[model samples]
Target: MTTLYSLYFSLVHAFVGLWLTQIINRRPRLLGTWIAVFCTNVGLILSTAVYEQTGSKSAGVAAVAMVWVYNGAFFLSCSSIFFTAYANPVAMRSIGWKLYRFYTAILVVTGILIYFVIVETRGYTLQKIGELFDGKRVHLWVKSPVDDKESDGPDDGEIRA
Candidate 1:
């Protein structure tokens, strides 16, 4: 049963990767930054799923190969995020490297903690999961809604009440 579930997930991951890659390749310019991010994330997901499925079985060359692929995909995804930030020279200049360094450190630490510490909330209610992260440690995890007036800007003629 567990093996079947793993195989199913692996197939689904591969399918999603192939579908998204086709779409991304078709549209070379539209949302290129986000498309790169999405493709990297899909690669990470596909590799991780394949690694888990292979590693659960007896150790062999296939398992070793999957591990290598998973490690490469993981680092590639992380580096894509960094490279995206690096490409934004104006933001880098205004915000400074210290801020970017801090952001990257936070991202890395969060990823590590999530992989090690986070529990599966598969059956939990939304409120239950929200409560789990509703502390100083999880600050800014949930976004505040944007006020209509603020989003409307000065020229867009939606009259304020």
Candidate 2:
């Protein structure tokens, strides 16, 4: 599953990636930026869905796919952001240094959150969020009880008084 998803997305990712890069490069629009942001989210979702379905398969492959999808997508948006900033650094200056500082702070905070959301959770299960690609929830090693126990008896002795 990992190999299949990776192979499929990698091909699709290139076309999308190039489209975004050109959009920011040749024809820049606010709408395009918004679309790029949405595309980033879409990319994250695709990679995540694949991970969830195939988490039990291979940890390393899952990690690679997540990184590939996320970093590639985020790079598109960040590159566009930086390009816009480069094009109009004067606009940033107009807001004053304090606002610029605030802007930078927000970027850092949001970047961290985005990384956690997209990348960190990719190689994990619904329960073991910290670890990557474990079959069970985290390292709990919860062994399912044998079926014989249920069929053994409802109760060994039951006295009704």
Candidate 3:
């Protein structure tokens, strides 16, 4: 059963790569390439490692959970770095590879620390979990509903006389 689940995830991961490649071909960008490479390569490496290290059914379940967590973190990290690098091409050009390596190291270290430090949030509310991260910042850019009013018609909830 675990093997079947693993096989399914592996196939999905492969398809995601193919889809990303097609998208990248249409709109090439350094950040996209970096995300594709890291997500595919590191995901394969770490998931395989987890599978190899775990043999029992409980261990296999834990391995599957680890794979899911790792993938989620991998996607988010890639996204954050992509936006940062995309916004600063000059800095990306000068220190992109260095930043990539540094971020990768930081991710690994942080994951290890989190594995040790994080408490299970199974029963916690979203707000409670968010508070663990210090809550939201007011200064962060968020598109207002007013901005969407321009595109949305009167019947679509736009206030109109």
Top candidate on lDDT is 3
Error of 3 at 126 (Å): 12
Candidate lDDT scores, in order, read 0.43, 0.45, 0.47
TM-score of each: 0.22, 0.22, 0.28
Model 2, position 119, has a per-residue lDDT of: 35
What are the RMSDs of all candidates, in order? 17.9, 20.7, 16.0
Model 3 misplaced stretches (Cα beyond 4 Å): 1-73, 76-88, 124-161
Angstrom error at residue 85, model 2: 3.9
Q: Write one digit per residue (lDDT tens) for candidate 3, span 102-161.
A: 546655565555545545454445445556567552222334586553343333322334
Residue 120's lDDT within candidate 1 is 48
lDDT of 2 by residue, 84-152 (tens): 436435754565223333434555566555544433343334454434444343332333376433232
